[model samples]
Target: MKKILSVTGALLLSASSYAADLTIYTYDSFVSEWGPGPKLEKAFEAQCQCDMVFIAVDDGVSILNRLRIEKTKTKADVILGIDDALIEVARGEELVQPHGVTVTGLKQELNWSDADFIPFDYGYFSFIYDSQKITTPPTSLKALIESDAPVIYQDPRTSTPGQGLMLWVKRVYGDQSDTAWEQLAKHTVTVTKGWWEAYSMFLKGDADYVLSYNTSPAYHVVTENKTQYKAAEFSEGHVAQIEVAAITQASKNTPLAKAFLTFLISPEAQTIIATNNWMLPVVDGLTLPAVFAELITPKRIGFTPKEVAEQRQFWVREWRSAATR
Candidate 1:
């Protein structure tokens, strides 16, 4: 009994000694059971002997707002789920600090000028159409503009996917983008704030198509076990969206934060993202989800973050005139 008690005491001391902890602030879904949340926490703790304390908050904007309110006094060691639209806002607020370790291996995937943030996953924006309602899907962006079927899209000023669709027009039609928007405006039945509202409306037969990611259909086919919706193969390709993660300036623990970022890009985490999150992994060796590995593969498109950041304001201004005019 004395020996057993001594061993137990030693084990408790060992566990207590290694309780390194770090905090991460990210979008709520990121930590959800259905998302990458639980898997990442377990992986980081096991491999690095660190406790990952996830500060689950509202969407990206809410995370940013909280960061803004707290500033340098904030609790999170890292922040994830900022997109091209929100990247500028993050940059403007000076919310992030660089990781001492290089965020390498993203070179072939994304083209960004700085190293302050790193992209983990990316996808193209396309129209998700219900096959039951529309037998022949629109083949190109132009076809959607001319289609008789009513369409509903998320609002560009507010939604990330909506901004992606707006950028899609700018890249595809260039100077003719306004004219394209003018045409698309005619066919729009509703303009929603986010994918949930718009996609929910689409599912209920409110609209024929919803503006969303190319991999959006993967969830329906793989997890939901149905093919009620499919992404259109556009002639001009689709608008690309790259989601990034970075350590926060307000962090109390930088080393553990960097480790978490490394783990996120690790093969284990990437595999989870591909299968569970329905997103393309940044690392090379991670296997894609079977449905995505089979029915859907990522489509290539040409655009850069510098270009995205540069023309974003102009695109929104023009889209407003064309769409709401």
Candidate 2:
């Protein structure tokens, strides 16, 4: 009986070791020509001698919904690129497990909580304004809402940055956010389903400013090689968000998945994220792309998940009604 038990344990360990083909579900950019998907696939295969398959979906919500639909029969071993705002959905679904591996040199600010998730990089949401259209950008959220200048924003219920904007208002106005939303309602020219739509409209000269990240201009300045747009400085600071990765509970190769999470924090991956992914790396000492290293200034804000969570649904509902009118 003891020999049978020993054989059973060994077989279990062997099965786990053999199940190293990793499937990661993430957004489109992670697999795009400029993103880290190709590099990660190459590096992980080189290091682990296992297959790394990335299933690219439209956005974070679709990825989470796919996991929920799959449930116990989940297809991916890891889930990456979920920002702080959507981290709750991943957590609530019980999709993530506590990663035992430690990531080296993650920024102290990123240690926001000791949750199951690990933050890989972060950025702040601020209006990306066309400098040619508006010589003087609005310096505060109140001014943006009140300005006669045509403004475009993504719908808070559907868009990540739009959700960030809602959180920004809740953080600044607190209990009076309902009134603030009412004020913003009057100025909005259109509410898009996603950032791509809103930003495209702004770029085509339809609006003066489009709600987006401080780091967004980094992409234009560095990649596109022109500074046609810039992030507006707000007196109330900006809504900062951290993107995180996690080992999925559905992973058959838990150990390998954990190792990949560690790899994502490596200098190699963080550098790719900063230069190609258009996000600030979580690693403290890594230098950013030359243009970003010069153009972007980090904002100090009191934004927190707790405050944002409390008011997110309320803000989304209010915006929906106001937007329709």
Candidate 3:
């Protein structure tokens, strides 16, 4: 097992350029042509006059999984995509260390005071559909799960949105989640390993609805002037995913890592992330696009980070058994 993990870890470090002052590990979408990574990297480079690099992985979960495999020899100075649900899991594994950025100017609604993780952006996990095709949408999570509408979602074993759905069903259905998963699987077109795979399939008009963020439509409106995409606000509320960054326990560049984390919550970086990443900024006051106001703001409901960490494996096994039944 150690040899396998070592090989996997070595594969990640394959053929990189010069030694970067700071190496950030993040998701693939964040560094895409349309994502915030390029702009943020350029801006930070100009500010610090240092070579900063980003190593892109499949998704948020993939970042942590890589860290777990790499263990002590990780090349990542900071990991920037673990969501709120997995904070405890990361902390318990001792993969991350405290990010010493002051949380004074953040949005008060977040109520964040963790010494470890600093939130960069957040959004609600929602099922989105083309308004032109579906006139009437599901009013609640229950309705969506029970309806025969064909759906596409990520696998809970890999994607954060998929993990959110597991929590959502558990929160709403509780003891009946096994039944709910079986029913959902009935109409589920496919479960992919990552968010983009499922979202891309939905964009091809293969499914009626796709799991995504509530702010997803804002990107369509801003980038393409297309308003057909819309998120269905569930009556039962939503599971909020606050994407965060933390300095790795193995980092020797803690100062640079801390500076990068501090910059993440700043107005300049937050603006780029909000528009490009399609998520809400963690900072309080930033003049954003008018379309952002129109996005659905569902009531937040889910387990604490500690609770999620404790029972994640159990729920995952249940989901696996039930989803495949």
User: For every model in order, what is the number of clashing pairs?
Assistant: 0, 0, 0
Q: Provide TM-scores for the models.
A: 0.81, 0.85, 0.93
Residue 75 local lDDT, model 3: 94
lDDT of each: 0.72, 0.73, 0.88
Tens-digit lDDT track of model 2 for 1-325: 2332343334334434554688898877678887778877886576666788899765555566678789779888888866787766667678888877544456777665544777777888878887876787878888887667778887665566777777777778877777777777677788776666787788888887888778888888888888877988888777787877887888888777776776677766677778777878887667776766655565667545654556556667865665565
Model 2 CA deviation exceeding 4 Å by range: 1-20, 113-115, 296-298
Q: Summing lDDT over every window of 10 consecutive residues in candidate 3, give the lowest-scoring window.
A: 9-18
Tens digit of per-residue lDDT, candidate 3, span 1-325: 2332343233223312223488999989999999999999997776565688899987888888899999779999999998999999899999999876566577777888999999999999999999999999999999988999999998888888899999999999999999999999999999988898899999999999999999999999999999999999999999999999999999977777777777787778899999999999987678899999999999999999999999999999999999999
Rank all candidate structures by their TM-score, best first, as comma-separated numbers. 3, 2, 1
Instruction: Give the runs in model 1 whose Cα sits over 4 Å from its true position.
Output: 1-21, 48-70, 84-89, 103-114, 295-299
Candidate 1 has its poorest 10 consecutive residues by lDDT at 1-10
Better of 2 and 3 by TM-score: 3
Best by lDDT: 3
Best by TM-score: 3
Query: What residue pairs are clashing in model 1?
Result: none
lDDT of 3 at 17: 24
